[model samples]
Target: MKRSKALKVETMFNNFKLTFFLQPLHGLPETLSDTANANWPWQQDINWFLALAEFKRLTQQPTLHFFLLEVWSEHTRCLALPLCSTKDGRYWSSLTDVYSPSFNIISSTTLIIANPWQCLLHALTQLQPNWVYCQLSPLRQEQIQQLTKLNGCLRTHVFEHSENWLANCSSNQEYWHKRPGQLKNTIKRKRAKLLSSGSRIEIHSQLTDELMLKYWQVYQQSWKQPETDRYFINWLANYSAANGMLRLGLLFIDEQPVACQLWLVHHSKAAIYKLAQDQAFDNLSPGTVLMADMVNYVIDIDKVTSIDFLTGNDNYKAMWMDFNFKLYGAELFNINSLTGRWLWSKQWLKTTLKTIARQMHHLIFRARHDN
Candidate 1:
């Protein structure tokens, strides 16, 4: 089957058996309840925000087919499956499988009689695409393996877990107050110096669209390059505003906006959505100051349960959260087929090479730093 240029949601919905139940989860509803759609820091609903950004990104590619799979239930909230397919290249799909036993059951059953490992398996069987790609949390490795064994029609790839740090303000003051000793002291001194020097920091619970747009402009200036998903900024600005999820924290040095961060607040947790800081204020550690202020504000003022430093596997995340959630991605294929066996061998070779290269790079960097 040839990939279609124009992807109609209705057509995609009609092609699948579970479409009627899953469509609403993808933001197809005429109206969504606050309870159902309320933003949660680490919950799957936040992916709704991520998916829209992804969808808008793919829409820019005039030749690609974009399809979104949304799933919902009273028991579990909304989940989105954003997929992009191109005739000449690989098909890409966002991970929609929630981390739960029920999801594992459904996925396992589907693979028993299906060619592929996911709901997209049905679509792939019908469409016969070159490849179908999906991202899964690292914690779901067991489930992925199970599906691959059942279907014998997929390959698995693994990637780093996007780290998130959480601290409950109401219960654990120590966690909220704690930070890396050196970094914490440096930021504390900076904050004290700035306060004594008459600088002020302001935290806003809600942001106006105009102010959010200003932050995006600052982001563009900071990067100084166009990203593949240019529409992401606009989507975030609008979605946060529409859903009352926007939290803008600004660090002003003598009444000038030197640093700013966009955060999402939901279900007693706050997530660091995006950040922008002026290059000139780098010496003052404006970004660090802003983060400190947010930690305190969420704990003392907003009384949020936790805050997530999403996506960066940085050293800072390790210091903040004792435990981290691992994100896993894999390719599943039939081990019995010659093509599948060949693909697996090639992937294993590539992974081995990359691992060796990474270790070599780390050693070289460490030696240089020690010198």
Candidate 2:
């Protein structure tokens, strides 16, 4: 199989150099800062090999291997990884590494050296695996379009929307204050109720292992109801503990946990990775109150440039978000190969069928409503 070529140490400065490398977790660079203006959440910089190693150690998964690409610039450095899970029970490949690529459409020279789509195509063509996956920030539309054009790639699926709202610290406060309308009224009512009942919302930076375990229990119970599996919760807890950029924002009412959110600081942006709410307190809107507080906290206290609601296309995200971008998943292969050609044809037929089915469903539903 043709693995991506690695650039020689001497010619690393030449035009658009590329390399494929691997290292152990213990051998990670002492600090991500050593790589010139790299993003925060230092654990992401631990080198792809080390990150995977730590993941393996904590999760005890023995069949995983890491493939990484290092991209360099005069003012910045970044890394990408093609993660493959070879475990008997698990089956998938992902493009999720630590640091995210810079997204400025203009003046972002980093793309010359690191093209994640190209790297992924090479991996797929060589491996010819079951599926390739990556969670792209909804903001990168150009990148998505480029990947969609790949010869044998198919966009198998995508999550519909996010349930949270993301915004920048510098956004107009007055606008936000007036935007929520009835939702805002509900929040105030909930806060008044909590206070009247002698309860208070307290945010914490550090949590005990026992508390963390409790948070996980709530998270697992909520997560299991969904069609997707929560495979990364365990890895996230350990990773957040090891990396300072990761934080847990918890809301406690009278010393008992009511809500918790897992947040990560990357570059100048904050991401709401996971959230859980206590079922007993659902009537009081504890989750909403915690989210509202967290939003203000990130903007006022942390001073991040933006917040990402992550994957979903939820209505709440649209309500408060001033910006949004579409996300796509695609598969690529060598079109000339027999298997690749067959898979591509299958995808086209499936997509066509889906479109027809959707239209028919809509028509039938409309007729029933009319009747």
Candidate 3:
């Protein structure tokens, strides 16, 4: 049976209504694909990797529900977001972080809900989800704040999630110019040293099957094991072949492969999915050199508006990226229920302990320095 519902929301400015349909990935839906591609551009589109069959085969979690949420005006659909929920009514999280770097509610334009938090709470209350709660992950502060403010029944918990780095530039020259002077000089010096040693770096923007296999081989030489799922890799190979969105860059020393990066690009945005380099070539700074080369490709040739380092605050990312944004996780607990109350109490205790620990550490450090 097709499960669907519509709710009307009265905002101060306008009366907004939304339609939601349950999407079971028994097969790929054109509507799902169209909505994903149309709305989300900067982030990786979910439709690219997981199909209905794949999702069913991989995610064996019980009580799972997938929703295609559409906000419609009188004539046209204004916004759409995909949501997953557990049987107990909790938002479905990733089986592993490597599988999905971020979870988001996709929309083409900035969401204009007169009071998004209240509206969302009202919808949830009406739906009467099995569990007294749901949690959305990998959102920024501003996005989480919009959903955190609810009335009496729902309590919110926001956790420190991940840090992402990004560089916004029009051209390679402009990118280099934006970097700190010291870092710029260091990169230039490293490039000069590698070139002087007869080592050449190459980027394979055009991904052929053979070339992709080679890229994987190079990655294995440096990393412990592949963090990405096998199914994901299979999907990526097929997707890249058809879409031409994968960019693999390799650094070579006298024709020997040393470092490799797998980048995914769509529309005008690009993200570094994975990067690895041979430990033996550590002295050559192959990873850094390869990154520099990839940046040029992303900006100069690909003409990407931004490059996301994706979910890390590593020192190297700071060197290249001018700014960063925070990703947060929000858990909405039902204050009316016992289980929800217990969970909230435990969460509160954890936060208090963490705060006390930080204060103690600061005091100890101050005491030592003062002496």
Model 2, span 175-267: residue lDDT tens:
366455877788799978776655655544544677677676556545324413233454455555555555677666777777777777656
Which one wins on lDDT? 3
The TM-scores, one per candidate, come to 0.68, 0.66, 0.77
lDDT of each: 0.54, 0.52, 0.65
Q: Between prediction 1 and prediction 3, which has the larger TM-score?
A: 3
Clashing pairs in 3: 63-87, 88-131
User: lDDT by residue for model 1 over 1-371, one digit each (tens)?
Assistant: 33333222222322333331222223322213333353342233434434543444455545544454433222332233444445443544442322111122122222122323454444443334455343344335565555555443566766544444455455445764565687778878888877776777777755576676556555654533445564555555555656766678877776667778878776677777777887776777777888877777776766677777655567766665655555455555434456656777887899999999999999999999999
Flag regions of model 1 displaced more than 4 Å: 1-62, 69-80, 88-90, 95-123, 126-150, 168-172, 220-230, 334-341, 348-371
Off by over 4 Å in 2: 1-37, 40-65, 69-79, 85-92, 95-116, 119-139, 149-165, 217-243, 352-371
What ordering of candidates by lDDT runs from best to worst?
3, 1, 2
How many residue pairs clash (N, CA or C atoms closer than 3 angstroms) in each of the candidate models, in the order given?
17, 10, 2
Candidate 1 residue-pair clash tally:
17
Model 1 residue 43 CA deviation in Å = 6.4
Model 3 lDDT tens row, 268-292? 8888878888888787787888888
